[model samples]
Target: MRILALTSWWPEPANNGSRLRIANLLRALAQKHEVHLVSFRQEAVSAQQIQRMLRICASVDVVPQRVWRPQPGEQIVSLWRSEPASVRATWNPEFAARVGERATDARPDVVVAFQIDTAPYALHVARAPRLLEELEVGNIHAHYVNQTSTHRRLRAWLTWRKHASYVQRLLRHFDACTVVSDNEQQLVRRIAPEMEAIHVLPNGADVHGCARDWGSPEPDTLIYPGALTYDANFDAVKYFISEIFPRVRHVRPGVRFVVTGAAPPELRVALPQAEGVHFTGYVDDVRSLIARSWCEVVPLRQGGGTRLKVLEALALGTPVVSTPKGVEGLDLKQDEHVLIAQTPGEFAAATVRLLEEPELRSRLASAGRQIVAQKYDWSSIGQRLVDLVAALAPHTVVQSKRHLPGQISV
Candidate 1:
């Protein structure tokens, strides 16, 4: 079977969660079928990266992403021509034409759009079953920004409404859709109730890389690893510094917090200066930090979908204390796989308790690792994606019956 996977960018060296998801999904598809990747290349892709794709993919076509801001007349014409928000005009117009040309020659059996921005190109391929993978409900994040913004609140609110409308319009076109969690699936349905076949394809981690026995932890060390430049993560770090970490330090004076991930100067300045707070600008691997930590903290106030950070921590057998919003969409129970806290004081208390009580930390770490190994490994999640695609394009190829060692059969 020939599958055309469309993405907004080349998903190689998938250091981030979103790119990791697409890379793993394509790896799964490539195992059983011919996968031709046609994606936008925002920057010059490294030769090593293209070679990585060449190893797994049948062929790859990279469409150069260029800047295109329309003038007043062009903006009017764009609004008249498409239901998508005007911001989408920035997408290379030649993308759809390129996809059309490929479809004419390669004749793909199915088209899978990895993100909402690339759905228009996938939908343009009329004969194939179009599958849209919604990483998260974009409007939900837009709403979060709206609720949190001060000076730009009105602009954020308007953007949220526009994205909501765009989602409703796009939802009606796809044959099937998948989101990162049940919570996001419900959000999509609420926004567009008439649509069916919207499924929950939860986020996962590379358990094999993370499923290991953590060595002796550094006493009183807490780690928070994520894309710190993202609004929610930046806010989470700031919230911890402002409201949560001080409370923890008061209880445990030696407690030190490590904020690790990519960050901009603005995000860095947003974090309050404190004696115990340390920031690692970017990390190639967070497992070392997680392994050496007394516990991992996720004090997220606003974010949608399940957190890969939580999954990665759990897979590493690192005890985790997170806010209810932090672990949203994951099937985790308080005191079982993780310790959930809603308020800053509660979060701080959870952190201090995990630090002081060795037995509690051990129990949570063991349970969390067991949960991810059993349910959230990449192989199992990849197979789930395959199952959905198979159902949509059953005539294309027979679904593989094989599963990874720890993977549950799809």
Candidate 2:
């Protein structure tokens, strides 16, 4: 079957969780089906990165998007008029047009949109069984709204309201939807209760790629790998550095905390200047970093969905200390597959315990690896996705109406 997968970003050499998930999904899907990927490339990506993404997918097309920032005058006007700075005009009409043209020619059996932003393009395609993969609900924006100051909170609230409406509207148009975790699926059901088909397809890792020797002793380091620009990751790192790291240092001054990922300029500036904290902007081999770490810490407080970092850490047989939110989607047992901690104090305590008790760490690591092998491996998860697409296809029929100009039709 020919499948057109739409995503906001395509994985390349970059260490991005979303890109990695999408790439793994596409690669697995490509094994049985002819998969074509269309992704939106932001300015940070290069030509080499595009080529790398192409190599992973059967065919790849990218729509270049420029990050638009409001002018100083526009910002002032927004403040007075009570509008958001995030407002930007879509400039890639040709990309949408090309997708529609491709849909007509390729006549794919299925269309899958990876995120809410790409849903609009997929919705325009009227001739295929459409699946919207909602990795996370917009609940993070609500969290941000609570975290922001009064002035910012009002703007965030307004922006979130608009976005929520847009998502609900799009949800009705798709034949089926899939989310990374049960938590996100529940949230979707609450908002769009009428939607019959909502599947919980948890995030998965490349277990084969992550397999390594667990017998070798690792360095006394804790690693946190994720995109720093994301609020959840930024908050996790900030909480660790400000509240948890200090306590951990007092207990074990020799242990190092490594923060590894692509950081925005603002997050980069806020890095702790302490002796034990090492802020590596981006690294090519995140697995090597995980392999060398004593334990992986996932202190995410404000995000919905299953974290790939947790899966990757577990896949590498690295003991993980994370919040309940961090391990929400997976079937993990506390003190076995992973250590679940909520507060900063509990998180620090768990980290220290894992670092000190080698036997406990070993037990947790073994259990975690077993969990990944059983459930979160890419091959297993991908087969489930393939089955869903096949099941939905027989009931799906192509509509004759052409989508509006600049719209994507699946």
Candidate 3:
């Protein structure tokens, strides 16, 4: 089967979860079918990187997309517009035109759009069997509206309403839709209850890659690894510092909290002044950090989808202490594969307990690694995706109008 995979981001040396997911899936799909990738090139990718992607995929095409930085006048106009800020930002007429042209020429049996934002372009190929993959319902926006200060909350609420409506309308057009987890699938169904084709395809880890150097640590160092620029991660660190760390310090004063990720300017400025908190802006190899750490911490309060960090830690045989929200969508038992906490006090206590109990930590870590190896490995998860595309391909009808010039369909 010929499959066209669409996404805004693809793995190219950058260690981002979404990119890694796309790259792994494409690689796996390529093994069974003629897979072509049509992705938005937000950043400059080298020829070497392009070649690397081509080696994994049958073909790779990039549509240049500049993230629209709204001017002051445009920002004022956006307030009155029905479109969400993100929709407006990613809206590109030329890019859509190119995508349509490519899809028509490629004439794939199935066209899979990676996220709702990318659905607009993929949906333009009207005659193809379209699959919309929602990594997570724009929970960041929902989180903002629910948790922000009053002034920001009002703005976020307006944005959320508009985006929700937009996403629901877009979702209804797809032949089939997929979410990252059962939790997310349920949420998507709630938003678009009439859409019958929604299904779950949980996030997966590159177990073999993560487990390469799974060794026990000597000291009690807690590591939080993710894109620090993201609001969820920022909030997680803030909550840890302001609420959890103080309590943990009383119990274990010598322990260090290593915050590792790409931090934004605002987050960089608001670093924790506490003695034990070490903010490492970005690390080349996160696995190394995890290997050195006694346990991994995921204090995310407001984010949707299963976290790759948790999976990676589990794959690396590192004990994880995370909030219930952090481990949502995974069949994880508290005090078994991972330790779950809701409150800051609970989180601190969990961390302290894990730090002190080496045998318990090893037991949880070993169980977590086994779970990741058996269920969440990319090889297994990617095969499921390949099968999905193959099963859908036979029922796909290539419309006559699809070949006609100037007729755009998704």
Candidate 4:
């Protein structure tokens, strides 16, 4: 079978959670079928990165991402468009033409689009069974509505209406859809109630890489392994630094907090300068950094879907201290798989306890790793994506026997 996988950006050297999902899913599909990848180049994708894709993809095409920003006095023009700037910016004619041209020649059995932005491109693949992968729209709904500013609230309301309407229209075109969590599934349902076939394809980690011990966690240290480039991650780091880290530091002055991922210098300026807080900008391998931590702290007050950060930490036997929202859609139990704390005071107290009580840390780490092995391993989750695609295009399956490990026998 031939599969055309569409993404907003090239998903090579998948250093981040979103990239990791597409990379793994495409690799899974490539094991049994031909996968042609067409994506937008958001940044300079290194030759090594393209080589990584060549290992999994039969062919790859990356065009420059559509660069669109509201010019001075374009507010009226943007409003007249009746769609959010996000949707307007990603509407690339070059990408659409490329996808259409490939779909004409390849005539893929399946078309999987990575996000809401790329879903429109998948719709152009007129005959294939389109799977809207990881269409997590909850992030758009999670912002700006609660602000005190009247202008901001009004803008957010308009943005929400336009974006929701656009997505609802797009959802109707796809044969099936997948979200990272049940929470995201519900968010998509809320927008397109009449639509069906939305599956929960969870966020996961490479547990195979976690087979060997990821080294003993360093004492008096806590880590959060998400990049500050994303707004939610930056917000999480800021919140931890401002409200939670200070409390943790007050309790244990020698404790260190490490944030791993690329931190743009501009974004770094906003984070409160503190003594024990350290940011390692852009790590090639974050698992080592995660494994050597005493605890993984996810003080996320924003964002939607299950956190790959949590799953990766659990996979590495790193006990975690997270807010309820941080573990929102995960199959985790409080004090069993993780230590749940809602307030800054509670989060700090939990972090201190995880650091101080070796017994508790060991227990949580064991429980968390067990949970990840059963549910959040990339191999299992990648197979689930294959199952969904197979289910969508069952005609592609010719036998009762399976071709790949964990295949659905479709």
Candidate 5:
């Protein structure tokens, strides 16, 4: 089976959650079938990264990424459009032309759009069964309920209504769709109650890669493996540094907090000041830091899909202490697979408890690792995606012979 995949993210620098998911899923699809990746080049993907991708993908094609920045009048004008303003804004004629041409020449059996961001392009792929992979709409809905001010709530509600209607309308273009968790699956059902075949496919980690010893755990240390560039992650760390960490510091003065990822200078400078807060800017492989930490902290207040940080931490045999919202859409059980805390006080207590109780850490670590290996490992989870997409075209024979570079465009 020949497959064409569209992505909003450049799967290189698989450092972030989005890239890693897209890269691994493509690899999985390419294992038994030829996969042609038509991805938006969100950044400068190195020659090394390009070569790595070609090893799995038959050919990799990239279109320049154009972010849709809503203009002043766009919101008011969107009220008159059939689709959301962002949807109209996202349509790139060059990307559409290229995708149509490629799909026509390659004659793929299935077309996969990685996220809703890529759906506009995927829609241009003529006469192929489409699969909407990792479609997430829950986080938008979360904003409506979580907003504090009435104005913010009303704004979020309006945004939610727009996106909800857009999502429902978008479902008409695909044969099937997948989301990260049962929670998201439920959200999709509620939004589009008549929509069927929504698969719950959570984000995965490289379990075997993390299972390797990266050295002993660092004493009195906690890690949050996410970049401060993302709002949720930035909010999480700020929430921790301002509210939760101080509480934990009162009990355990020596405890350290480590955050890994690139930080914008302004955002970095604006971060709340605190002792023992270290940010390792953009690690290519964060597994060592994760494995070396006493535990991983995820105080995420908002995000789409499941978090790979929690999954990767579990894979690294590190116990996780997360807010209920942090672990939303994951298979983790509170206190068993991970420790769940809702508020600043409870979160600080959970962090301190994990630090003090070595036996509890070991227990959660063992349980977490086991669960990740069984359910959240990329090898298994990736294959599940492959099987799901393959099911779309059951009768097609998978083309096993590798295509020579001379035989097709690379």
Candidate 6:
């Protein structure tokens, strides 16, 4: 089958969660079918990167999209329009026009909008059955942003209402929809009752590469790896440094905390001036650091969707101590695959206990690795997606490939 995927950003520097998900999923889709990617390019992609993508995808089109800063007048106009958000409106015209032209010419079996950000562009792709991959129930994320971030409460609330209505209205036009978890699936169904085929296609990790054997961990070390520029992560690390890490340090003076990921300069400067805390701005690969650490910590107070950071850590045989919110969609059993701790005290205690108990760490790490290997590897997740697309494909387009594996209902 020929599939066209629309993304909000270039799916390279697959260092972040979303890009890694798209890149790996496309690689898997390309195994059995021809996949074409149409992405918004923030900066020019290098020739080397283009060739790399071409190896995985049948074709790749990067549409240059400028980041726009609207004036007060434009903001008022956006409010009056109340269709796409201001940020989304800036790129939609050019993006949708390109997608409309390509879909008309290629006439692919399916047109997949990877996230809600790309839905406007996907809606314009008129030549194929549309599939909207709702990476998160958008309103939930917006609500959390409003609750947690100090910079834009009013804007966040507005975004929340807009996204809730936008999703409900948009899903009705698509053939099928998908989300990262059962919770998100329920939210989508509730918001858009007219949509019948909403699949719970979760995020996955490269278990093989991350799961490779590593030497013994550095003693009393913990790592939290994520894009710190993201509001949730920024809040999390700050919260951890302020409330949680102090308690842990009080108990274990030698404990070392590594905040490893790309971060804004303001955030880098704002990092707590506490002993034993080191901020690694950005590392090319975090697997080695994850492998060398005693455990991974996720103290996120906001955000939706299954966290790829947690999944990657688990894939690398790293025991995790996270809040219930942190591991919300993964359906992980508390104390079985991970140690769940909610408050600062609980989190500190869990970290201290894990630091002292090598056997417990080994047990959780082993269990995590096994669980991810069985259910959350990219191969199985990608196949589930392929099956979903095949099911949604036109009978004339998919009938020729009936011999393929049967669809796995969500």
Q: Largest TM-score belongs to which candidate?
A: 5
Model 2 lDDT per residue over 1-410, tens place: 77788887755654677777777777767666666777787655666665555554456677775467667666546544422444334446766876787677667889989876677788668868889876466465546556558877776666565555556777888989988877777777876788879998888888998886645555679999987888888988888888888889899989898888887777777866577887787788788788778899988877766788899999988899998878877899999789999888999999999999989988988899899999999889988887887777875442322222222222
Superior by TM-score: candidate 2 or candidate 4: 4
Runs of candidate 1 with Cα error greater than 4 angstroms are 64-86, 138-158, 213-216, 397-410
Expressed as tens digits, the lDDT of each residue in 268-373 for candidate 5 is 7888989999988988788999899998999988877788888988888899999988887788898899999999999999999999999999999999989998
Model 1 TM-score, all chains together: 0.88
The whole-model lDDT of each prediction reads 0.79, 0.76, 0.78, 0.83, 0.86, 0.80
Query: How many pairs collide in each candidate, listed in order?
Result: 0, 5, 7, 2, 1, 0
TM-score of 6: 0.90
Cα TM-score per model: 0.88, 0.86, 0.89, 0.92, 0.96, 0.90
CA error at residue 192 for candidate 1, angstroms: 2.5
Give per-residue CA lDDT, model 4, range 211-287, as digits (tens). 68667667898999888988889999999999998888888999999999989899999899999989888888888
Candidate 5 vs. truth: CA RMSD?
1.7
RMSD (CA, Å), each prediction = 5.3, 5.4, 4.8, 4.2, 1.7, 5.0
Query: What lDDT does candidate 6 reach at residue 2?
Result: 76
* Per-residue alpha-carbon lDDT of candidate 3 for residues 262-326, written as tens digits (9 for 90 to 100): 87777767866788888787777778888778889999888777788899889888899999889
Displacement of the residue 68 alpha carbon in candidate 4, Å: 3.9
Pitting candidate 1 against candidate 2, the one with the higher lDDT is 1
Per-residue accuracy of model 1 over 156-254 as CA lDDT, tens digit each? 654555567778888788888999877688778888888889888888989887756557779999999877868888889889999999999998999
Q: Where is the poorest 10-residue window by lDDT in model 2?
A: 401-410
Model 2 lDDT on a 0 to 1 scale:
0.76
Model 6 clashing-pair count: 0
The residue pairs in collision within model 3 are 123-410, 124-409, 124-410, 125-409, 125-410, 126-409, 126-410
**Residue pairs in steric clash, candidate 4?**
261-282, 262-282
Q: Residue 251's C-alpha lDDT in candidate 3? A: 88
Clashes of 1: 0
Off by over 4 Å in 6: 68-79, 138-158, 397-410
